[model samples]
Target chain A: MPATQEINIQKLGLIAGGGNLPAYLLSICKDKGIEPFIVGFDGQTDSELMDGHCHQWAEFGAVGKIISFFKSNDVTDLVMIGGVKRPPLTQIKPDLKAVKILSRLGLRALGDNDLLSVLKEELEGEGFTLHGIQDFCDRLLVQEGALGRFQPEADDWIDIELGLKVSQEIGSLDIGQSVIVQNGMIVGVEAVEGTDALIDRCSALQQNGRGGILIKTRKPQQDKALDMPTIGVQTIVNAHKAGLAGIVLHANNVIVADIKTVAKYADKYKLFVIGAPIDKKSKSVTERTPKA
Target chain B: MPATQEINIQKLGLIAGGGNLPAYLLSICKDKGIEPFIVGFDGQTDSELMDGHCHQWAEFGAVGKIISFFKSNDVTDLVMIGGVKRPPLTQIKPDLKAVKILSRLGLRALGDNDLLSVLKEELEGEGFTLHGIQDFCDRLLVQEGALGRFQPEADDWIDIELGLKVSQEIGSLDIGQSVIVQNGMIVGVEAVEGTDALIDRCSALQQNGRGGILIKTRKPQQDKALDMPTIGVQTIVNAHKAGLAGIVLHANNVIVADIKTVAKYADKYKLFVIGAPIDKKSKSVTERTPKA
Candidate 1:
């Protein structure tokens, strides 16, 4: 949770995956005069992002190559960003280092959180200090209160509270990080299909009256240094398309990529975007805005 | 739960909703020589199911008319069957009786389970004995063990165990009754979209190696006299189409509509259909069949 200004970035290694967040991070590095050595995944990371950077493309299973690339460039600080689909074990042709790690981990079924945790440990074990995306840029972190002009009503706050409780319960099990609730009923919960798909599926299942709301939060047991729950401009667009009334994210714990553009779209669509703090005791959300 | 044979059902009243369960229940009544006074919901119950049977179509909000119709037929034993979409409050134009009941209940957000629970209480208060579908037909109740030629492998069982735990967790919150799991990851959980849509959504998210397994159970706090988690022939077909290896249902709790055809389809598609007993203490499933 240290401020971006306090962190010294000297020859950082960026493991970029799919999404706009990686490109955003790259821009931040440019602004700060830090040239990060980027390691892009074969099918996951966008090839276009690697155009004018010191980067190397590696398969997800090429753990040895990724490590050596970072080591060769003297990049001691590492940051893993963006989304990567969990491929089946059969599909991943792990190199010697990855095979050794997989074997040591006992090859049981691993969720995204578990996989990332293992990766963090492995990289740290090899004498590299891994950093979260938040460590590089504090601007990307979601702030408290409504980001857009619109604010959720009293009834909407009730749904938000319920959604927070449900999302946290599911997150404790490492299932998913987002949930859609309309009225008092949960329309849908995000799983492996991702948040956008969850919104699309729940659109057809919404009840007759008021639209649903999307609540995204970090998993309770999730490592912040690993994958933090993220929301972007695309999320607002999807929520508007799905007739969602608003979007809620756990304050500070969630990453809001391109916050200005996200706020613009949310305002344009008249959807409220609020980042609320989680009440640890009740395991629910507390609305910061006083009722008018 | 009383045995179906022990319950003397004379002049039964059925409040039929959508899906094949209502039709299936009607056929059972015909077989047992119990002429049920059918009260079908408008836009919900199948029209064909009412042919040759003493039935009346009533809107969901016309509680007064439905009650009088059943009373006129001297039918005191009532059973609410099939699925009914939870309409928005604006959509429902409730009669005086329904309005009184709803107002007395102080309508907050009511899920399907809560709605059904309210209906059960209202009906019983009006001198009607509420009986579950299981009261008229025990044959439809799922039995313990595999129903098809195929049985789940060890890995599938492991996934089933994980699915059971997750589904129960969601069910306890009255969120969902079914969850799809592959390896150790949850692919999707059913909400208002239902089991079929959940299967369809999870198909694209499945891992490459082995297919996922669908685990369905009754919500822990759900009333037995209300809607039971049901699986029909179409469920088996959909599971197979989704490349699911098998399905596991809570034994004796879930309703298996047209079980014979369900078994036939399961065997034809080489998908295992199992009814596993849930261990209440652990809130997990116990595999009844011994591993070979």
Candidate 2:
């Protein structure tokens, strides 16, 4: 009998940040018979994620060391997941490689998208393939249909459309990614405070306990591979606590973590979770497009 | 010598809301040798402002009653001033005349300016002249200069410009009247929430106690006689509490409730108060255009 054919697994480099996402991704990689190597930022990645895993700590801006470490592990494919507290320039002790990337980007590096795009390009130039998290965990993307029992009322759809228009306009300005719309009026636009604070502020401004919908989408000029708008169980919980009607997200443009758990909490709270396909031409959300 | 011709005093109508502005306007009318008649809205006009004055209370949407009250007092010139809590649609019990007005201006009846414009037309149709609050109280307009010890640094000016562009864009959409910008990033955009709430939201989002500027401007399509952006001592106090650097206003556009008190508070808090002349062509605030 012929000997069993030797099997080879593709090695992936995981740039981990804070939260359970990295660990979840690692488990998925193992289940899929893929080799995983992790490099966690000093103050960002969760320690639990590093347990019994091939992981090492590096300062956020130590680009050269990160690349070399990944190379030594034969990692040519990379995915960056989870959140990082954007540190001030003073806190970022960049190595020479990072400084070169920053200087070359110049004023265009003012926004998060621009900076991340530059990093993506740098990694590609060094012969690394940068993949979006969805590449490994496509199931985590929100499905097209309503997640829970509750569906949006007609008036809620009106508010959702209004939110889509205004949030898109603001996103076009590169100002923010989310907006709170209630009764066809904009309640708040997210800026530096981010989604959680935006939700809190909108909740406080509710009139007669009337809740609104939180709509988040990708910035018009954003690179799809980096910094897509992300939501998870915490987002659903926050919206529920804030008395929000539901959440509307652009299909193929937003990421959801632990989607089953998110759907469970949403169902418990009777919150609607929908993945809307936004029509750029009509500037409105079209029919739902189910994820492939 | 022939007997001196009989002096005639113009009868001016004061449509007052909740605040010290109506009383201040009344006093200015007295000093200017004009007879004033006050028409206050129920739950909106302060008792102190109506005390010892020829005034009557009417529901906010009681256009017929308001017109009749002014006509009985022989008031030809009218000025609307101060704040009115925007009542919900259910709360607005519009009289017959107001219903007619609202119907005529279908979609335009949505915002403050459109309603005020319709009111102005109705009053003008009956031979009443609508006068701006500034006409009677021009001294309340903020002069184009730094009002306190702490002047805006050059970097603050960059933020101020970015804010002006953004605020104007949002204003054109009739979304809000104020925006808070810090470190060249938009901190918050005021919508249903008023200026104070916007400031508080910005303050809470500050990293390392870094403060920003609060910019208030006139809506591009807003009627000057209706609802001009007005700031007062409380605005300065709130900005100070929020750890904001200063306040920026449009010259000859924003109303200061009590210029002296606002200036005093600004000085005490070491905050700068400057009135900028926005150049529509250049989309930037030009040099100081001091109030006359």
Candidate 3:
């Protein structure tokens, strides 16, 4: 988004999880002179970050309390930020309203994406505008070019394309949004285990120090407002630890938490960070950002 | 496959690698009064087992010497048995003929499957009848049903089906032939690291003791006579170690080495061994062996 774009929203609701993304979003809201009301999760949200910001804490599966907190604050616009560790259903102490929601969506077979989508729909049904974090913080999205000093080599580009293709299939299945490829073979596919663990596992299995490329993209059917693929300095650091050659992400489709720090880390590690262009014609193949 | 069938071929060639499969094949040949000529890779083949047998040792990629050794032994039919750790190209001391073959097929970009297929074609060109191990030892193929005392529960069946679907897609891309799915989510997909490693990774990521199902099948375009998916006692032991609920193999398409021991292991571990039937219309989805 252009810097000159005028903001119209007055009150924004932030559903915060773990990571610096939530704090960054809050800071952005403050800079734009918008009132931010935060609904933090019990074990996920960073407590210190939300100290002075009007916020309420709820258990991971306390859907009823989360919805009520937003409604009581008269917040009409909401964006879920950061990541939540998927809590076990048995541990979730659901209220009557949460029970109703859980009953409607059978808990036995729902994957993370499916459950998030259900919650997003439920929140939207309550007369609130569900906003993708990008709406308020588009600067976080990386541009379409190399972010660091290094550019992908010819072979690295081939691996990047292969990773993209495999990641699309992975996303289509709602498995996960990252794949590591090297020497024209898929080294790893992200599943329930997140990207860091995936890269760590790949590193253990990688032959020698011959590095692979890591690709992170949005799931084909993912709810943009709920969870978009987010990468930051830690991703670059982890990729380096994993002995990966580079990292490729879809431009305008992924949130690069802090591009400057991320680029600095990439340069320090001699790793290329390329923002792959999303094919607009095939929206499903490469996830699209929410339309303003 | 039936014991009543009389053997006509006098000499059988075995390209041995690490595992009980090659030894099992040789023993079968011995019982059937057929001469077993072994071409063993130095590092991979079980040295002690082939000690007294008529065998010749060659480096992993000594393609020329392997073919020549088979020819000198008057072995017209050949079966590549068990797994060989992929040797680095720099370590491969290819003879003049092997160099010629490698040069014709530029070695830089070929995957394991592609390279194996190329070798299979080259061997066939030399007038040797390449046989899937099943061709000579059909009794090793699992019959469709519950092979052990335990049957797959309903949820286990669901995970098995999910694994089959994912494994098919993985195979179609010529990545790997196995997938582990538990609680309706893919835990792991086999790649270059192979099945035992894949299961080990899945076991690490698996939540609780709720073991998933492991499905192994043939790649869509895989040359069956070259490198068919093989499972045996070790596979059962590893699956048991991985805390997997059961093992599912495409009936007839997979080689079940030492079936009695495998079944015994399955029963002891209370793990179901299922021979899932392949849909005739979709040959790539699940592999089916010839019914006895």
Candidate 4:
């Protein structure tokens, strides 16, 4: 993973999509005195985030125009951030460049991660170096410890372990990155429904007594340059609303949009938010104890 | 898989839980002129299913009494049928026999399948041969071919293939039995919430244009004698209500609780219900075309 100091901030390009992540990244760029060239997608990117920032708006399939916009602005270091609802292929009217890229991807179906990786390769081929959100702001990366005042108990650890195992298994298949486990039983696994909806759906299904815990991790085959599992203050609020006891995320492999606010929300809801150092092979926490 | 002819119907025992499966099995037993000794769970089993039947009701944790009830009735073959909401472990008051059985299960956590397999072994050790519902009535098993007028189009088949692949992957991990796929993206996967809830949750998340298809299969590590994926008229109705185009189930491996009614509902709702002969290793349908 490239640290902030190693990356060139000059002529940075932000491929913004929906959600607070784009806005959060914009704030970080502003703080560093780097006004990034922003590319916003129609209906997907929040327009408010691009206000007063050098940016271009285009349809999701306008690959040719999107690339030219970044190239003309001398933007080489690019970061794609935020959520984009995958539209049906029929609805996307791809330009010549996008069509060529799609053709190179072949007729076979592509999972979400696969599509992102292919897009990353295509962008890199166009002479831009793709970077993960962590490249600009490493502080957004979750560290190994409990973020809030609360800590997971012994039984919660067991559920967290099971959740990590299941999350990795699903992630390896390019399925999803989050799973809800309660009392050793997986209550729900997120697919295209996203994390918030997954939390909402699992609330009614949780077994009686102790609440479930949400576990989020990066896919084993995931290209960090393309995407990484992310959470924010909204995630904490949703987890708390779902009656979940806490949330466990893979340390250094997930992006926390607003760390301070997230921690404050977690504490307010009496929920433990911990980042665990995960062993990729074993899908287990490398260290059992949380740092004080 | 044992056929209906091979299994002896004499002194059959039906361990009934909740859902239409219990009552359906009971009706089958009556039709076969065999008055099965039925053991119903107090809260889990519907009392209506036990009316006018030779049955005894007990709490879910009354392992000793449940065994003696079957043993004293001279029930050599037992069939555990229907759905049971898994209660928190702390709520269960294990009897002496259950305590011994639980001890034998060891201290490690067990998934639903593992727990069922362990219980099957314990019962077999107690001189009762456990059989799946298929043993009593193989007609309930879904056969290869479309069950209704509608047939899946090319796009739907592609989605079905994707669904099967994901379903098998999840199943191999003992995670889920069903998956919903639309436009090459998996919308949802069933976990502890079961298939119905999975469909309902995916309904809102489905992409625009065509609706998704539901694919169900037996878990790769699943014990057929212990349990198999079972769907009924309610499943068809739910799929229809969820805006699903069709349902593809693994033939022979999945049980159709009431096939005729399910087919009727499928046809009435303009939904396709097909059973494909699945190659478990490849997780692909062996026969592609629907039988006329």
TM-score of each: 0.95, 0.87, 0.89, 0.96
**lDDT per residue as tens, model 4, A24-105:** 7778777887768999988888888788888898887888999999989888899988877767787888899989988877
- Candidates sorted by lDDT, descending order? 1, 4, 3, 2
DockQ of every candidate structure? 0.78, 0.39, 0.43, 0.79
lDDT of 4 by residue, B1-292 (tens): 4456646566778888788887877787778777788888778888888778778987767889988988888888898888766678888788998888788775442578877887788889988888888777768788877888888887677777778888988998778899999888888989988898898888888878888999999888888786789998899999988999999998888999878888899999999998876675677766465333
Regions of candidate 2 where Cα sits further than 4 Å from its true position: A1-9, A286-292, B1-9, B105-108, B111-127, B285-292
Cα distance off (Å), candidate 3, residue A225: 2.1
Native contacts kept, each candidate: 0.88, 0.44, 0.40, 0.84
Interface RMSD for each candidate model? 1.2, 2.5, 2.6, 1.2
Candidate 2: clashing pairs of residues = none
**Cα TM-score of candidate 4:** 0.96
What's the CA RMSD of model 2 in angstroms? 6.3
Error of 3 at B91 (Å): 4.3
Model 1 chain A lowest lDDT segment of ten = A1-10
Residues A1-292 of candidate 2 have per-residue lDDT tens digits of 1222323447888888877777778888888888788888877788778777677789878889999999888889888877665565456888999999878876566555566777789999999988776676657666656766667776577778778878888888778889988765677888888898889878877655458899998888877656668898999999999999899987667878878788899999988888776789977876442332
Q: Higher-lDDT candidate among 1 and 3?
A: 1
Ranking by TM-score: 4, 1, 3, 2
CAPRI category for model 1: medium
Sort order, DockQ high to low: 4, 1, 3, 2
Model 3, residue A274: C-alpha shift (Å):
1.3
